[model samples]
Target: MADQPTPDTSPATGSVPEARIVIENCAVATVDAQDTEYARGHVVVAGARIESVGAGPAPAGLRGVTRRIDGSGHLVTPGLVNSHHHFYQWITRGLATDHNLFDWLVALYPTWARIDESMVRAAARGSLAMMARGGVTTAMDHHYVYPRGSGDLSGAVIGAAAELGVRFTLARGSMDLGTSDGGLPPDFAVETRDGALAATEATVDAHHDPAPDAMTQVAVAPCSPFSVSTGLLRDAAELARRKGVRLHTHGSETVEEEAFCHERFGMGPTDYLASTGWLGEDVWMAHCVHMNDADIAAFARTGTGVAHCPSSNARLAAGIARVPDMLAAGVPVGLGVDGTASNEAGELHTELRNALLVNRLGPHRESALTARQALRLGTHGGARVLGRAADTGSLEPGKLADLVLWRLDTLAHSTIEDPVAALVLGAPAPVTLSLVGGQPVVEDGRLLRVDERAVAAEARDAARLLARRAADA
Candidate 1:
């Protein structure tokens, strides 16, 4: 049932009636259990579920297909999944350009603290539009900053994702430790621990859908070890387990974070997280750049997953993550764009190339990562990290019709011999079409549901407003 689309009744979804779709005369890369690939093939979709995929033209006599798209000069693959992000940061890009992990957060915290519902909504709209147009069918946001009375920030983000027509997960993040308590964020930005927990629970109760075909889901997330208290971490783990939701947080992204863990709790980030009951199958942490062999072993042993953000890590001068070692050690790994503040190119396809290039700089250059492995990290690996692998990772019968048609015949990519290699190593390919739940989210290199120019203008205004408010305060 993986990749099954939600059977939505909402009036706002679109006007297109559900029907069959057949895409033929194109290549297929089904990142399935056996890594199936075909130089020329076809795919059939009935309503929201994939009906068939094979090496030749879609079996003849396919009936009732309202959409018959000739996918010549294109390669079809599973839609990319973004395992981690900060949608609110869409309006905060290009700031703190020369700072490392800690300084970058410190510099951006004030502006982020001034965000409200309106600001977050605009920012999220721009973010989701960019990703969806770039072939991301599923996205997740880790938003933690809650200034005193920012009305419904989570709702604002959720609404934007819905408006853009992409599967979404709102990782309800909180930060309780403030400057007064030896933490980094200003006191005014931090929420009361109890209040944060209560709000997270309520958000889950209201928005989370457990159905395999659900379009929206919720996760319990604390900001990070340095900015969130010990009690909060333990309690969050318990709450997430009780509610049967996944857990996410920042972990081991920098040496400074490790030093903080050692100074405050007499352990490294991974050990501290484990002591707080945060290491388990349902938990996926971002960065993991500074993990040692022991930490890798622990993550593999506990079935914990890691989200690899290569561009963000490189931008912030965070060390290269031990991705090859983790993979060899059996740790489930995925790719994340992190935040636009750290990685201005908030697209997932580029992450595939960056992940492949950055990991090769280390001692194990030969085995760091392969192009196919990189693609897996962006698609199936992300699904596994979000705890939804059984629902939306690969292209197989019975999975949701969430996939992309990359135009590899363009001038930039046509000369390359291998489609997969050209996609990962060559310049980024254009998305001819992207579908979410048997509907067109993007077509002909443009977003179908919203105006791109309008979205850009809204994002600019929101960023300006947030900056002014921060200055005024």
Candidate 2:
């Protein structure tokens, strides 16, 4: 772990030895401005940024690169970006799978209220490790369920990310509207409006890094309209803007939510969001499933982003988001595996696959999304949503060398004519190599910084303890 690669190893202008990392002879999907691809290519990663990407072996005059990786027979793509997740929900998998979004929250809010520091640390580590193995280099987690006794659970998740060596974005999520306040969340799972805003600001001041190569960033994210007050939403937006961090929350996830907003605020979800000053470039909402054409146009005009969680929406019977229409309308859309309770796995591959299939299911089959487009939603689009587009989205030169090498030569993928297509169409494959900031976090399909088995065992213990406590309560 001490020797894990970091980007700051070399000076910006000095004639230091370029610890150039060369991955030779592989199929490259750059996913850059041009959506470039190479049937057979090589990528040179020096320090933390990509120095060059081209066909064949490393170019001439490239020296001081002692590390060499055999990328042969693999499909190389920018590491998947998970724009939205709930790391603490890793312990809640297989629960309330048959319930819709509202019922699912009703069934699990009490259980989530049991989360503490230990539970969050174990769960976050397990979830982050799972994402790392599946080629996700960057992840954004929205964790708002803060019990009274729970102390700094968000920090615990950030600690787990540090241990895993993956880039992390923590959405300092809050829920202030409890069931007593005409909201969906239980009282124990909600916070006071003032308290929520204070904690959000404190978290940002303490952890929000504005550096170009920051491994961790913070965003102010109130849980959702159904679980938070309008005042909190406005305040959170103001605080995030003042602190120069992004804003995130759930929106238009279900028709029930729309009805709630209409009955409570005399408008739809989008209208409520706009009234609260949350409709802008700095805001990215999760699950715009019930959005109308006008809402889509508003999102486009405002440059607001969306995190499309396909598997969780399907599992919860939440309506499919009009993603193709959103994309056509120029809404910046990204991929998210939501929470483990609904998705059953912290896997970006599931999100990518479901995003492609779900878009083609309804009347829009004639204009169905292609495999490449879905892949972009997981990679490039995710970066844009998370406000990390200038850094780690693609495999272009000068970008952070955060990428994945997948064994497309395996039996499951070998049958396809295109390797990229195989990745989108086939089952989720373990990454042979995964790098974040030029550090190989997953080499040969195994986590390097932490023991996966120990993490899983610890997580299981914590989850079992939580389940027992919830049952007794």
**Cα lDDT tens digits for candidate 1, 90-189:** 9999999999989998898888888999999998998899899889999999999989988999999999999999999999999999889988888989
Candidate 1: which stretches are off by over 4 Å?
A: 1-18
Predictions in order: lDDT: 0.91, 0.89
Candidate 2 lDDT, 1-473, residue by residue in tens: 01223244333556667677788788999999898999999898999999999888777666566667777778899999999899988887889868888888889988988889999999999899999999999998998988888888889989999899999999999998888988777788789999999988888988888998899999999998888888999888889888999999999999999998999999999999999999999999999999988999999999999999999889988888999899999999999989888888788998888898998996688477888898899999999999999988899989999999888877888788788889998988658889899989998789999999999999999999999989998
Count of backbone clashes, every candidate in sequence = 5, 0
- Cα-based TM-score, every candidate: 0.96, 0.96
Candidate 2 has a TM-score of: 0.96
Candidate 1's TM-score reads 0.96
Task: Supply the global lDDT for candidate 1.
Answer: 0.91
